[model samples]
Target: MKPYIFSILFLLITSISVAQTKEVLLKKSFKVDENTILNLDLDNANVHIIESKDDKIHFDYQIIFYNYSRRKINDLLDDTSINTSKNQNQIFLKVKNSLYLGIDIKYKPNFDYKNFNNPINDVYKEYLKKYYKTYRKSENLYKTKDSLIEEINFSIGRDMDNYIKKEIDNFPLKKPLKTDKKIEKNFIIEVPKYVQLKIKALESDIKCDYDILTEFKMDSFKGIFKFKRIDGKNNQITSSNGILETYGIKNSRIQLRDMYKVNIGSISNSKLKLEKTKTKIGEIRKNVSINDSNSKLYLYNFGKNFTKFNLTGDYSEINLYNVKDTNFSMDISGYNTALNMNGTKTSFGASKEKELTKILQKKKKENSPFLGNIEVLLKNGIINIK
Candidate 1:
């Protein structure tokens, strides 16, 4: 027999009788243009959207409220809902939740609204004022603004709890009202095909496989992206730390920027704006072309050959592979560069070179241009074009 088994059963029965139920939080539709820009920004919610043949965007949202003790005036947690606003061709949606330290306050104790001068509250405010006057004067003596706000909130919460407990005879004590940590909503949305999409999510995965005649943009601060395919338009994706996958891609203006890693399958259309904060190529499928800023691009077996690459910024590497009758061109300028290509013609020069009359009475020969070129410019970083 386990200790406190009867007590545990009693507690479970009590909780089951009083646990808050889930309900539909928000349900609304707006007038949308034919080619719309659907923007969704959330703190922490898994967003799942599939393109249907419908004309208007359909949203179905639900939330689970916890830590709410049933009291008088049953409208307790009804004010917390998502906001939807619209402009000309853009529709913005947002849900503020506890993911980013958002507080969920419960009001079970009788509010002292009639009695305005609360002794407990006055004592807490007095202490807060004294501390503010002593330690929080300067504007530029801290590390970050966010840290300052967090510190002030901590001070207020501690002081209030201590003061209220001391005056418990006069002031009623309050139990902390907190939502469950599993507070993300299973958000669902459906929209038309010809629309641009933008989302800002935290700790969620974004999977976009829509291939229509429109542009797509997503700035995921802490989430990852799964890009399957794209049509004949532009696509921009940015992430903090996530893996990206794009398989069937065609003539599109694509920009894949990340602070972590990217994986691609087949990409065409010599318009790739790639920027990676790390100094390594995560993965590439085949014949991928990119106008890159910085990263080590390791070229293995050209999956679908004829990959063109143009590079800029610091400490980049290019590992090249040779095929039959495949001519290549490289325009590299930097302080230190490493090119490791066996059985390949190599050339290098400083952009600040002299003329014939000033130096050797002859100009440096230019190599015949190829379909794929590696043009580089650097100041004090290694340009590894292999």
Candidate 2:
């Protein structure tokens, strides 16, 4: 009887552990106006939204685009297309033209209340005094009356004033009392295993009367896209403007921009039509043995006047278990360029011209456009000019 009882307790503990380790899936959508200057959609897109007690919200979305221009993606990532309050936190990326992407929200909650307690408060007060003394001395040495510098000094002073006021508000005046035991609910939504989504191109049967841009004619356009999955399967879906129906399965959200207009010379008596096709291949896996994870890859192709072109590329990525102190490599190849790096040896290719190469090489060494400390190497080029 004793042995049976012990066995039952062990089984119960195991069941609880298993339940805690399970993953959940969530889906939500926001309405977007089609006629607006920026027509974007998050419908059926896999998005991860998180809310925390720190009075902060976070959104992580995996987005893909179709029939959109690369310039539009660049504008959105540059924050030119969206507006937010001064104190808000925002981040955006155009992984692909047909796929406008971004993660925008307010700052995370403040956990500094812990510093207002007894021992911590004393340490903080001492540090503040030292900081102010050092800063003032440095300002005196500069001795410049430049308005910009003065304005910056004024802002710092105002911030210090606010800090003092906050401290006063948190001052404890009376002994705290223990109230009755009460239940408080806290909720957290873990990041999903997969954000599955699909996007179909909408075609209009009626041809509209429009002026053709002479500078933007093409004989053939071909390219490939690469996608990475954190937990589930990685796949690709392709579509063309001529297709009257929707095409492709997206495991995340899809954001489409406008068609990229190019200068393709004047229209002649002979009628010409442009054709494009994109092929996506298998997932790029890291050779190292590590825990499960996922990533994303983007490709942008802009062509010159009428010409036949062919492009090919491949990518390889390393998986990481502990990103805090681990080093990784991301390799990409296409259009006669290759990027290779470990921690420091990074390179970039922007254009066939020497001037552009120098500019891109400089941008590569700067901070990563993303919020992390990863190094980047960018190589870009154009082809088949008439």
Candidate 3:
């Protein structure tokens, strides 16, 4: 993998501007091999990739430009960018955040209103006291054209309630007057420990305690991988609201595409493919296969190459707890769906068991050999795996 392009530099040229707090220092040094294949694509900012025994590949950056301006810091020293590509053991980087501000400030709301359907005040005092009591009982009637139409409805209802109480007493509740424009970039990368990281982020925040990778591709948009530990054995993570706190990758083969709920903690000897994701889960250590119409997945631990769990979703849901005598194999079908499994040497197969929803298995002591060949294909939704 080779591709590097960066025109617009910083790091010892010591002649900067931006009319305010300004500083830039981006040290670089690279000389690969020993399993080097680093790739990073960043956005917003806050990343730190560590692991160095001095094998090479160091980058110490420090950029600050608050409220920039000076022709946008000289058009970021003239058209900013940092894109790269390298091969024969790969190394590609792309960074962007060219401290800008050439001149742009457009705000709205010059204030002007006339009662947008009773702008508060108990909705104009309960509909103006029943509309002036039905206009004084329909002008009671005093001849002379009903007393000149009740003096023109009491002078247009007291001048439309004083122009709606002067537009609710001049609306404009503070704030807003902020000429926005700010930029800041902070990163410290030092590679060479166990190389193999393919990360892509947007509104960034990443930290990796590298362990010499083999393969890891993470695509996060609204990023956050705090205190991450990499152990790539063909690991793939595709995220939106990114936040993966890896404990220490091992026994791998995990492919996850998450959007909503599924905050895993530990995984081992993995084998998973979670797509269109969100397994209403908090944590699961392995063994999974899911496909969703929307999203929902959760298989409470069975670590060490977790015993099989295959799920297919529609309007999904599967919540089960550590059943007593756990011997797994549940092939569920879907409709109005619901699978609520409990415990006690749970055995089933033969169609419908109803001992008042069985729950009488108590002398138990055995912890997860992790077996559950549970196969569920849902359309509507319910599979009580007990």
List lDDT for all candidates, in order.
0.49, 0.24, 0.51
- Candidate 2 vs. true structure, TM-score: 0.16
Lowest lDDT sum, 10 consecutive residues, model 3, at: 103-112
TM-scores of the candidates are 0.52, 0.16, 0.31
Instruction: Give candidate 1's whole-model lDDT.
Output: 0.49
Which scores better on TM-score, 1 or 3? Answer: 1
Q: How far is candidate 2 from the true structure (C-alpha RMSD, Å)?
A: 25.8
Kindly report which residue stretches of model 2 are placed more than 4 angstroms away from their true locations once superposed: 1-253, 256-338, 342-386
Which candidate model has the greater lDDT, 1 or 2? 1
lDDT tens digits, residue span 102-190, model 2: 22111111223534564544545654685587643542221211332233222211234324443534534222212111111111222
Q: What value does the lDDT take at residue 374 in candidate 3? A: 53
Cα lDDT of model 3 by residue, 338-372, tens digit: 44554323332323442222222233224545444
Write the residue-wise lDDT of candidate 1 on 268-350 in tens digits.
Answer: 55355666633222223323455556654544222323444544545454443332233544455554443334434333332
The most accurate candidate by TM-score is 1
